[model samples]
Target: MPLPNGYSINAASSDESEDAERLIETVSVPPQCCSARLNLAVLMFFGFSVVYGLRVNLSVAMVAMVNNTDPKPWENHSVVPAACPRSSGAENTSDTFQQPDGVPQYPWDSETQGWLLGAFFFGYLCTQIPGGYLSGHYGGKLFLGLGVLGTAALTVLTPLAARMGSYWLFALRALEGFGEGVTYPAMMAMWARWAPPLERSRLMTLSGSGGNFGAFLALPLTGYICQALGWPAVFYLFGGAGCLWAVFWFSLVSDDPRTHPRISKEEKDYIINAIGPQGTGHGWSVPVLSMLLSVPLWAIIVTQMCANWSYYTLLTSLPSYMNNILHFDLQSNGFLSALPYLGAWLVSTLSGVVADKLIEKKVLSVTNVRKLFTLIGQILPAVFLVLVSYSGCSHILTVTFLTLSTTIGGTSASGVFINQIDIAPRYAGFLLGITNTFGTIPGIVAPIATGYFTEDNTLAGWRKVFWVSAGIGVCGAIVFTIFGSGELQPWAVTEEERAETDKRRSGSISQ
Candidate 1:
């Protein structure tokens, strides 16, 4: 057989050559032909489903755990050792005292609580680059499973930490964030492997929607668990669920379509051909400089930052908002706060499918389709934020605006998440990590900022936070419109590099 551009035939034994040829023949799936690919995608999506479910459960549990009074009066009034003075190290002095109004404050005070909320992002932000690297080096299945397991273990420990004291709780949450951080990149890597070109948007959107589902389920489930069995039970339930998911994931998933024993050859070929030649390489190093310089990449990052500011704010603070501002009881707060996430779940599912349909029919260019969703997602929410800010204690209007804002943001999963795949399948994970790192800055900032803003429970302070959120949303929309494109740049890979990749793949197959 003639050698392709950048490779030559190996001088191996006939047996080796025959095995390579047979494997290649078996794996040469036609586009959209493989049932195994779909099965794998579904399994992977479920893995993400449970991972997110457990991860977000903390948001709901926090409402009960942080505010609960210790039954043992001695435990409540335990004196600090001289070596552990309230102001020592990073500890907040205020956490040691009950509030003047007799409210049960977090043991670590307002500043310490801010740190606890923000600390998770410190580990989360730090892990993105490394997680992407690991996903590339080790493949998605192993890293993703291990990440879930790690997250599960940490989650199980959270209740124990709370029982022990505040410092341990902060430490455990940060560790959980580190483990959970790997999930998105791994999911992106899986999409690059399993999804056909036509189905990329829909599949990615559906997979990403699992997070919304998790958020939606977490509130009511954790609330009930807290109410019935105490806040500790919430962590125990989510943690146990995560571990079960990891067991199934390890049993079922493989990183490559070819390696999956259950996948048909036709489907494997289809997936590979649809993804094209550039998808073959899997290495820790990515074209970091090229991604950094790309205007579209920066646009995606900025949009993610804006989108996540609202997302994290709601995730971390909405329960408190519902309790304090709306005056809902715990059960009511849990059920109501979950509504926006449910709305987002529905919106994401529909938008993803619709975006794919638009792409399939050629009715809208991929760029236009992405832009349409991104525009509606950000702009509408900004409008709603303004309304939410000015509603002035009208509980009904405030909830309505909040719901609209979150539901609109769901359109981002269709736009930015899928667009990352469109721009570069090979580096999709890395690009997502970079964008996510940028996005998480707000995750780190928003909770603390909210604490500062709402210190006095005044409407004016709350209004300022919403206005800032609105302004950020508007800025993201403008940037995305100006710079976002679906087209992959030539500089992302050279002609020589492409030829070299094709050569290697063809040579390996023909051996």
Candidate 2:
């Protein structure tokens, strides 16, 4: 019988399977081959590194910004603004506020700072669905390049915003957030297109490690820039770097191996053959009913949310925390705050390589390997966070435990990110966007909660925040263990979907 799409439905003949195997063998890089793929991986890594470096620069700058200002206290003896003489010392006091020529300054209020920090995620949270859809329809290259360009433009504008005022600063930050919202989904879609099944875990991990590296670089580098040239320079330097990357990206990258002029025909065949049946065609909308009803997807979303809570809390609050609680100078605080991310970058790269090797060796089933790493990622970090919280004021113990926590947390790239590819290679970007949208909700809430919880620098307050993070981590680990799986469910496409796919195929053939 003819297949529904006019292809033969019969099982592949031994001859056909043999032909496919021979083609793959002829085109495939040897087991140790890493040249072309490694080059592509490095390019992608630096792309994400630039994106995240710009994103995190603001956090480091906030440390210096806060320190340079004088604190105000409310007192009954203090004269009101209305009661003070027009030329009184209170009116002319330079210590009360420092308004540099091109730097943005705002009242030194914790709540306002929290709002500035959390506001980016608001735009980030809103754009994932649209970004994923665009990446699916137009291919990742277009949206990915656009995302880079948009963010770079916004980054350049940030310095101007600071010079303009606090309101402008917030507006520019929101725009930057919106532009960056496109990045992950676009990159995820690119992975679906470019990565071989065997190499998916490793490549995704490497891509993710770039973000950690960005965090590592941004803290100290931006801090030094802010210190030397003032905070506005941080935006100008990173923003310029991002713009330069966009130029390189548009010239070098393509959505499919088939279209890339630099990719050899042999490599194209290898990539296409490696991906097998599911890699063709533009992605369709997820079957919302099925995904919503799936207990597994819900569990994954919950686990992602839990993971992000800890991650964003550190990203948003760490520089300030080191300066305040650890009593480090601005330069020292920047260096110390970066240590965790340095550890994270190492752990992320290593875990991905190890996970892929285990799969290649057949030492663990795909599902079990992913689960093993997921548990390690969540549970070990949870334990370390608790330890870090209780380490008293000992700087050495504090840094050690925080480093351990970040290193362990880096394994999520192996577990959660790679599992998206495993479960839905065809729709990996959309599925990831769905879960990431939920995960980023905590990005909004966490910084605000950190602001409120640590308002007084009391030990109890900080302890409470750590406890909540640990509890969330435990719950995420439990949910992932119970429901996360590496296997894809059989497609339950409706008749309409099948028809649409068939029509598209026919149209391609007629062309």
Candidate 3:
């Protein structure tokens, strides 16, 4: 792709001073492996993994942490025809989660537990906009490292906070939410500099998939920790790892690739040529009002919000459902709950590949493929959740339904999830901050709503929960299908942006 006679890809002005002209060089080729960018992607993958591990550990440990009343209250009100015999996990109670004699268990009600589980998102919402702007303007590394460090430190204190009372737990978790909220936006900012045009999707997906992987591994492992050591150990071990990772991040990472000490000159030059000047922070600012008026932006927001409602419902509530309604022991509950995330993690990677292939083949417009996959992601998950509702006492059927719901929902990663960058690459990080803010709403509301609905852990209550989630998913898909667009919005261009575009266009033509 290098131009004839070694012309610079940036198409700089001919009137440049001697020094500026000397700095311009022909486009260099990217390294395939052992390159600085790939190293960043790998470390970032683990960064997301550790952060997400910190996020989901509560869902599984909450099973062992709460002391439920022995059966009498909901037995009569629970779902009928319980055809599947009770699992030994429910009946054997010889000692579930190892129930270490001295371990403390809270007498929290379902609604309160819901409140506790959803507490993280309370702080998550408040930080997104400011985090996006700060990370974009200053550099993502410091914020990203600090965010994880704060969350990890708070996580280690979670047991103490909970023991202090429900209010204390809420305040502490809200702070953790505040810390972790910067994660996605901060990473997006990093990618704006680290990712070349051709490598953007690959690098981003590689790093982002860590969330799914973290949930998959952490759940079963947390179950074992709760069983073998104690619930407190779950928090201690994961939080400790998170703290260590933050230190490692600061030691190894740089905000811009051009400034990295260990990066090869060839790779640095290649990355520079491949990624043009992007973002507006120095003298310009985002057009917030125009974004508010954008239909496509709203569609992404609405779809993200609705889709995440179902996701958080499963994330926060699924373990409770397995434990109380399905009567799974702590160990079984964690493994079963984690299964869906494992399926989701695998499918998420594949769906992006499928999306890219379809686009490469020219089988559909970028917009059409996005809508198509989004519909597949949303509608099918709704159907599966509906099935999960009717699965009755059949553990096999319920697990299958749950797994299918999450596995198929993975397609959304290739859909509206990445559409923000397509619509406005320059503002991609900020837009993600906006979308994730609304998306975090589900994480807050779904758990509380689920707790409110399933007070007695009755079959009928869980049914209603699934039905509501299904309905929301359907509505989100419908809105996105009708209003989503892949093309960049006209308002994305300002005078400075327009000039940058003209330069790039002229460069392409010159080639």
Tell me model 2's lDDT, rounded to 2 decimals: 0.72
Tens digits of per-residue lDDT for model 2, 291-354: 7786667777889999889888888888767655555555666777889999889888999899
Weakest 10 consecutive residues, lDDT, candidate 2?
79-88
Please identify model 3 stretches exceeding 4 Å from their true place.
Answer: 1-29, 69-98, 279-284, 360-363, 494-497, 500-511
Best candidate, lDDT-wise?
A: 3
Question: Which candidate, 1 or 3, would have the higher TM-score against the true structure?
Answer: 3
Residues 1-511 of candidate 3 have per-residue lDDT tens digits of 2233343222233232321332233345666589888888888888888888898899988888877634432354343332234556453241334457788888777888999999999999999878877877777898889989999999999889878988998899899999999988888878777775444556776778778888888888988899898899999999999999987899999888777999998887677655445533322478889999999999999999999999999988888888777777777778888998887777777776677656545566567778998999999999999999999988889999999999889888778887876566657778889989998999999999998888766788899999999999999999999999766566654454456546666888999
- How high is the lDDT of residue 299 in model 1? 85
What order do you get sorting by lDDT, best first? 3, 2, 1
Best by TM-score: 3
Determine the C-alpha RMSD for candidate 3 after optimal superposition of all C-alphas: 5.6
Root-mean-square deviation of Cα positions for candidate 1 versus the true structure, in angstroms: 10.1
| Global CA lDDT computed for model 1 | 0.70
Q: After superposition, how far is residue 456 of candidate 3 from its true place, in Å?
A: 1.5
Q: What is the C-alpha lDDT of each candidate?
A: 0.70, 0.72, 0.79
Q: Report how far residue 169 has shifted in candidate 1, in Å.
A: 1.4
Q: Put down candidate 1 lDDT per residue, 9-104, tens digits, no spaces.
A: 111222433222322232233454336666666666676667767766766666665653233432565432111122242212222322234222
